[model samples]
Target: MLIVCHPVLYSAVVILRMVDRKLSEIAYSIRESFHDSGYTEIFPPAFLKSDKVDGFRFIYRNKIFVLEPDITLRLMNRHITENSKIYYISQQSDEYLNESLKAGSEIMGGDEDETNIEILRMAIKILDNLGIKNYNIDISLTGIFDSYVRKKDGQHLIRAVKSRNYPQIQDMEIDDKDKLLQIMDTRTRKSGIDKLDSIIERIDDPRIIIDLGTVRQPEYYNGLIFEIYGKQEFLGGGGNYIMKNLRGCGFSLDLQALSKLYHGSHERVEK
Candidate 1:
């Protein structure tokens, strides 16, 4: 029998096991939260048809197969029943992406604003359970920048804005780059519906900040968009989108990255 006695390798394996256990604990707690909210977990097909998403592809029997880089497309089809609230935690594969788990949910058959509010609230609840206090959810209306951006060159402007690179934006052919810059400077604003603000206001959570600037790709998102962050890392992001003409919104959590929040203390993680 070959002997295997590498102490360094053994320690690395132990560390991986510890982190894995903590990640499971976090996922379980968050799953219960979803269940309490009437969302049943689902396992989506490993591959699906949609030209909207980019992922690794292979040909089998002359048919094209690909993995989803973004889980948002899983609900792109309007097969979801009205009044069905669903969540899924499954492996997601994409071009250039290795090892990722996404926990997401979609609320169908509800009022549009209500869906936005519910999904945003649930996103907060998930992050809360994970003990990520130094975080905020930046909310923005999709297509708010439509008037200023040309359909042909909007993606480039969006990338510059997303990176907060003002110089790059100014160099673009756009006549009014300042208009886009102003959106990036925002911290908060009131939507016509005070009720949505009412829910978030009382939580006394400092993590919520409204962003009026983030560019929403009309093809991807149509209404309210939100992203969750811990310090500077993007833990999750989702928003309202029209898929197959069906209006809906949802969020997806990065389960693997969430383990970094535990900081190696199992006792605190168990808490």
Candidate 2:
């Protein structure tokens, strides 16, 4: 007897395999890049006993366990000395139980400007290594938004700005509403734009963008924040944060999204 296979199913399987292979290749490139930069790879446990963690929680043998949500937080929990450069390729689950594959590196303790430039360079190199040419890094300072986020109606204001709801933002009773609106609309500000300019000058990358309205994870990031984009599709983001009284800066790339983007671009090119 002979078996019959559907053409669509077979095609889907082949595409998935190609994506898997691409993902592996990208991950290897990321690890190699970090390794050459003198970053030591560290592995953190998947499950934590702390209920305070903002991650997927489950009951295991009548005990509560939380999946590792953020690799940086987990690493901060361990003893790390000043100037510790580390990297990890890990699976992280958020509060909604959505799992994502991430390749990231963290630099603990260094001159702010030097460390930031180093991280940015590494991120750019990873993209270059993967042959992702059409990409940009949107940079912002988290502190610039601190005042607005601390307001009583801060959350609503943030939502409005993120969505570019001009009327809604104007109606809100907030100081510097005009500035906020301008930044949201233009994605640039004169106040903190100089920091971004300095970084760009040092890196000399035309793909770096000064975006003042990037407000994601405002509470988590206390300093320079950046998001990587592959032709408008979000790859991942990172910034400076203080954890366990230690200052650290890092960035993570979404391996799955990257694989899709890379393969999709190549497929289109082939066509």
Candidate 3:
């Protein structure tokens, strides 16, 4: 069949391409902002040693297409300065696709990095022109492993389809230190309190405070951390991880989700 002569199919293809172009433009703008902010972009390998990916709160092995033993772009970075700001933008796997409506489709997806870093660099500039900004937003990440999971037929299953999968943490506006503490306790025990103190002792920085009250529920958050809540939920947050030979803090903005919650109805934004 001559592909170009089919009007209906051609129109569908045209619409999909147009939508993809618009989405790509938006993704590019997000990346460019990172460069303007003095971030030296690093390409980390997506694939890793099998053991490293294990016990992660996100994607698991059985769900992915395993073409190679090594993970793609397996990556990490170091700050040139004490607080050297670095920026990275690339397609990240939504490991929890198995739990969503799109589960039946081939779950493996990619984000834009282009075939070359030079192309990615140019794309970032285009995105900067498109008006993406520092947004205080509420966002939800899907397929996030909830600690309070269930075992049915000897296998763990997510408790609810979309129920609090990942806390719309960016949306939570926490004010009182005491209230944050209560939230921590309500979720889990004094898991961070003792270990946090030890991590503080090693640092001895007057600027850092080991507050049990400011905890975000992650099993690996074993040291210093921080976040800002803008009247509804955590806007942006990150913490230190020494065990992985990594030590850094980064902020994530959910502009699309923010637009939904405040300007309209909350929608899922890819992180």
On lDDT, the leading prediction is: 2
lDDT of each: 0.73, 0.81, 0.34
Ranking by TM-score: 1, 2, 3
Q: Candidate 1, TM-score vs. the true structure?
A: 0.87
Which of 2 and 3 is ahead in TM-score? 2
Per-residue error for 105 in candidate 1, Å, reads 0.9
Q: Which prediction has more favorable lDDT, 1 or 2?
A: 2
lDDT value, residue 207 of candidate 1:
68
Give each model a TM-score.
Answer: 0.87, 0.87, 0.41
Among all windows of 10 consecutive residues in model 2, the one with the lowest summed lDDT is 184-193
Q: Give each model's clash number.
A: 1, 0, 22
lDDT at position 248, candidate 3 = 35
**Model 3 stretches with alpha carbons more than 4 Å out:** 1-4, 52-83, 94-135, 138-218, 222-240, 243-246, 252-271
Q: Residue 192 of candidate 1: its Cα lDDT?
A: 50
